[model samples]
Target: MSTSAGAYTYSMASNYNRVPKSKVVGISGSEVIELVKRRLLKTQLVKMFRLLQSLFQ
Candidate 1:
């Protein structure tokens, strides 16, 4: 085996907490909706702040 392959084998053997390849990670539907809401609110607040700054200047 090549040096890289041997290193990969050694690393895999040394790590016992690795996640399986078949298992997928993701957010739930409600979490995604909440994340989008928070993002939109943050953007709107930033735009309002910028407008106020321009008005005051």
Candidate 2:
């Protein structure tokens, strides 16, 4: 007898041919918006710093 239930599982060959779904975690609209904001801010800051360095040189 098996020690655990549903221990013996078959591969995809046993089932019908179909595309499987992808699962993603830890993502939301608010999180996406926050990431975009951070990237934009960083780009602006880098450009400003480069301009200052060039002027001083």
Candidate 3:
């Protein structure tokens, strides 16, 4: 959903089905950004691990 200021907000459906949800981000007159999966934390952790490995190597 969007507000009067044009900022959009998204949420997941709380139903009996165990389906996953996605998030969307966009700017005015720009290409829309879509998050097909909810893996933000995992992605960050992977990145950090790679960085640490590189440093140790």
Candidate 4:
């Protein structure tokens, strides 16, 4: 029984390994683009804030 259970788990793991990384992570191109855009906007905002602080000082 233990051996059969172990074999079943091993088969499942092998199947998972065969799956695509993007599908497993569930992130599509659109989601990735949005994430990148958000990151860029955050960095731009931070830079602008820093510039304003430097000007004020």
Query: Which parts of model 1 are misplaced by more than 4 Å?
Result: 1-39
| Residue 41, candidate 4: alpha-carbon lDDT | 42
lDDT of 1 by residue, 1-57 (tens): 112223244334321243211212236865522221112345556877999999999
Candidate 1 lDDT score relative to the true structure: 0.39
**lDDT-superior candidate, 1 or 2:** 1
- Deviation in Å, model 4, residue 17 alpha carbon: 44
Candidate 1 has its poorest 10 consecutive residues by lDDT at 15-24
Highest lDDT against the true fold, candidate? 3
- lDDT, candidate 4, 1-57, per-residue tens: 112223234334322233211212125765633221112345556877999999999
Candidate 3 residue-wise lDDT at 4: 19
Question: If ranked by lDDT, best first, what sequence of candidates would result?
Answer: 3, 1, 4, 2
Model 4 vs truth, CA RMSD: 16.8
The digit string of per-residue lDDT tens for model 2 on 32-56 reads 2222111234555687799999999
By the lDDT metric, which is better: model 1 or model 4? Answer: 1
- lDDT, candidate 3, equals 0.48
Clashing pairs in 4: none
